[model samples]
Target chain A: MTVPRYTRLIQSLPASVPFVGPEEQERTRGAPFAARLGANENVFGPSPKAIAAMQAETLEIWKYGDPTSFDLRNALAAHMRVQPQNILVGEGIDGLLGYLVRLLISQGDAVVTSDGAYPTFNYHVTGFGGIIHKVPYNGDHEDPAALFAKAKEVEAKLVYLANPDNPMGTWHAGTVIAQALNELPEDCLLLLDEAYVEFAPEGTAAQVDVEDPRIIRMRTFSKAYGMAGARIGYAVGAEGLIRNFDKIRNHFGMNRMAQTGALAALNDQDWLAQTQAKVSQARDRISRIAGDNGLTILPSATNFVAVDCGADGDFARKVLAALVARGIFVRMPFVAPQDRCIRISCGRPEDLDLLAEALPLALAEARK
Target chain B: MTVPRYTRLIQSLPASVPFVGPEEQERTRGAPFAARLGANENVFGPSPKAIAAMQAETLEIWKYGDPTSFDLRNALAAHMRVQPQNILVGEGIDGLLGYLVRLLISQGDAVVTSDGAYPTFNYHVTGFGGIIHKVPYNGDHEDPAALFAKAKEVEAKLVYLANPDNPMGTWHAGTVIAQALNELPEDCLLLLDEAYVEFAPEGTAAQVDVEDPRIIRMRTFSKAYGMAGARIGYAVGAEGLIRNFDKIRNHFGMNRMAQTGALAALNDQDWLAQTQAKVSQARDRISRIAGDNGLTILPSATNFVAVDCGADGDFARKVLAALVARGIFVRMPFVAPQDRCIRISCGRPEDLDLLAEALPLALAEARK
Candidate 1:
């Protein structure tokens, strides 16, 4: 007749996930969306060689994946020009964030991030009973100086900043971010999420030395390498910090096919370059579509663009609802001011054509 | 110049991984082993349909996995004769264990397990700063009464019991376990890990109602389903307990190919039946080989056998070391009494032949 007793921290936490996935939406709607442009996924997909490699490796799925992620780490180290010990290959950046939060954040500990930054990071922070101190976005961009100041004020153990930010699709140059790191509080580690760095302009990656213990950069193959479903991401940090992940990480967690696919994806720089070109072309096409509807598009350095709906958040919500009703799946920012824009991921010509056709009708429906 | 301030718990934990993966060993030896029998992986591999489904899903790698795991959960729910809310599908049993520990065991919280049982579970408990109270095995079998008594004595929040257990390859009947539940301490949850239940005798699965709040049973696709590398496992429990996992789990941590592959694997029970039969045959063959080598084997209900080397812990270690050196990747128990037997995973016919060739030579080298 007795039940499990959860910890105080677990008991106090709300049982809400960070975001509801598109599949859940499709299931509830009893229909699938025509254009899957809401999740900021690279619709151009992974390299042909990566697909073949994963397919080939599928036969070897009987064995557990290498806990060390030796080959992938070495290849990544070679590419990043750092030692293998400085990189930690994990299930994904999301999983890595969870571990990092667990490592540093105890109950009532402070963490700092932008108010409208990655909700997943906030989810992990609050999940561990850490108090999240948020700074509002300065315009459409995350103000690093404000976030750093908040981190210092709150005595936060960690502060998060995403370069080529999500939802708004705006970015700071590598040099701009590199200089901003100086303002970061002493003992407060900066989580520089570069999940969309692959699609950003040249010199967008911060020029920080691998020996700098103040920052950990998270990069994912999901964005530009186009293996979002594979769930492979890495974090580059100081040797000691990276090695500390071995203490609590699910050592044998990576999928075997994913390990091989990501390795192949990393090697095929030509495909990544081609995907970049497609993303650029698609971004331009998306802007044209938005402009035709008399909406201005944000300057995006990521694979997605934010198109202003030329109204308040309430009006934008109606437009978003209409678009979803029309089977054009797109999302907007959770925080206000930015929520007036609808964020759309780069898709193939046909998928965007669906979006292009639906927007005008969706706007008309919203107006009515 | 200040480094990150780690939590007291994180500062205390050593940065040591639980088990060194076989791939790491292969990389170290500069050659792959002839037989990989250490990790309890199914040498027979997953269903042909699972492989094909994963291959098909690989093309959709640009999309993130469904955070809800809706299809997989619904399928598992129907198969297990339970409602969807009563189940929680996770990365694997390992990943689920980590979450379960976090839910119940806070710093200095009491947890109980057999000393020689699963190290990964112990690793998670300790990593979370939970104080583990060890119960010794009664001869070869884990004594349920002792574990229950210990939980009460220590005011333990959780007690772990893996039926048809790893390393020892032993089990009690379902009725035995069901009857033992009455002795479980009040407020203590029994983690009945059924990772090896598919190969066990009839009635080995406990006859507990899904509504029972005292126990949560974990099952995996890694064993009889032969999809270890794909990382899919589920936990069946009371609805309240099951739903609580949503508070902290990585919503999109699962690989997309794994989700589809697992669904296809669950539907094809024929492949599972074939795998169970093959595992049984391989176990018998392993026993025969041990007998021919003038050694005895513990009766096993798992996809592996514990062959008694007719020696002490030191001698068994030598034999295991020799076997690995001889290119046969067999492992042994970490604790005494169980360490007298070397555990060998069920391998293919050709792999067994390699094992047969290597055993005598390894023993000879060990005797030296």
Candidate 2:
């Protein structure tokens, strides 16, 4: 009955899951949600060509995918306007962030991010025993200048900034991020997470040199390409930094159909444009829905809208719970001030109609 | 031009790949392989049911996979006859091995493995700054007794053993392993990688209790199930240790189609048995091909055969290069004595026909 001896660090760490998935919630409730938009997944789906390509490649699933992710890297390089060596494709930004954290953070290393920015990034940092310094959001945006100042104060090795940030859906223009890089500390690397860049306005992607080692931009097909199920994401950075990822990466850890599907998705610009249009319509519809309910919506450049719940975190939580109770899946920011709102992702008209029907009733229930 | 401040351990590691896929070799040669017999990939392909399931689920690739992997875990639990709490599904054995290494190994921690065993295991151990103690294989078989003795001598926290070993295609009966457990040191965890167990003879899977805390059994869909590109594997260990994976796992990292396809694959045992029969026939055909070329093949309980080149490591390398030149993708073990054997994975009858045609010419090239 003797137990295996785990390492001290692992022994000290608490068992944690950054997010409990919708499927688990569904299982617990013994029923699936009517509208599945809580996780910010693009419900519209991937390009038809990607679906066709993946279906075609299903028979090739016996063979291991390219260890180097050769084709995907070349395609992403061409798309990002960078050399192939500047891009590293991985199992979504979540997996890449874990690898990045492992590469930089040893025990007691300092890292920085907005207090309520992506929790998965924070999980990776803390898992590696890194000390985190969090700066509160400036208004609804993740304040890049504040994050850099905190990184400097802590002598952090890494700082994470999500452009067109999650939960809030607000973003700074490319020029703002390009300027904010000047305040980032000497040894600190800015993790510029652009997971929602495709849904954001033009110029939202920072205009940094691909040779800038100070920042690595992570983008995902999970958002605009509508391939969250594919689990593919990539980071673009200075050639040398991207090369360093090979030091410990699981070389053959990629899925073959994911590579095929993502490549097809990248080549279908018309389909992407159509998806963008639909997302734009859904965003507008969601805003109107918020306004009709006498609630105000935050300005958003991403697919999701944050509707102010007219009170504090507690009230917003109650509304969120009520919506969940009514079979409309939605989420809210976990931090104060920002937590006064419920975040709703751009869904199909039918899905949003469910939200429309549920909100007022949910609000009245919350008012109780 | 500042470089990212990577951790000292990461800085110390050389960028390494355990195995390069056959696709990379084809790209380098500007030709596709006539016989893809390397990398232990099944050429007969996955179950038709699995392929159909994967194709059907392609359009649903818009949502992230069930982070909990609820259905797959429950299915794996039912198939393995273990409690669901004892299972931990992950991104293939490579990815799961990485997580396990991270959980147990710190810088300079002692670990043990056979010298010529799976390189990926060594890669993960070294990546985590663990000190690996290698014991030589005894008479072409991985000496479990020697591995356990070394684990005791070095006070290793982890000992890796691949039953139905790769490269040599050798295996011990399950009862041999159950007896070997008595020699394994207390406080040491046995990482029993059974990736090829389904291809091996009956009783090849060890008879250890699912509640045993001293061992963790890792199996994959990559081998007999023929879904290597899906990047799916699972570990069965004691409930508490299996629960520990939550502390650092990327909860939502799984691909949706993979989960669906693997569940379908698991449910089709009839297809699995048919694939096993095909593998057995291919192994016999490979042996006959080796014998026709004045070579001998190792007795295998796996989906591959190791043909003795009757020469040194350099000779085997020459033969491997010659085969590659002839568009035959085959590999040889890297360590001494074992290096005299070029490993050939079971392939389709047509693929084996190409191997039969090329072996004599490759041997002549090696002699030259």
Q: Model 2 over residues A1-368: C-alpha lDDT tens digits?
A: 34588888888887877988888878788889999879888988899999999999998999999988899899899999999999999999999999999999999999999988899999999899999899999998999999999999999999999998987999999999999999989789999999999988889998989998888999999999999988999989998889888988888889999999999999999999999999999999998999989999998888889999999999999999999988888888989989999999899999999999999999999998
DockQ of each: 0.82, 0.78
For each candidate, give the interface RMSD after superposing the true interface residues on Cα.
1.3, 1.5
Across residues B1-368, which tens digit of lDDT does each residue of candidate 1 receive?
44788888999998788899888888888899999999999989999999999999998999999998999999999999999999898989999999999999999999999989999999999999999999988878888899999999999999999998888999999999998989998789999999999999999999999888889999999998899999889999999999999998998999999999999998999998999999988999999999889999999999999999999998999989988998899889999989999999999998899889889988888899
Which residue pairs show backbone clashes in model 2? none
> Each candidate's root-mean-square deviation in Å?
1.0, 1.0
| C-alpha TM-score for every candidate | 0.99, 0.99
Candidate 1 CAPRI category: high
Candidate with the greatest DockQ versus the true structure:
1
- Where does candidate 1 stray beyond 4 Å? none
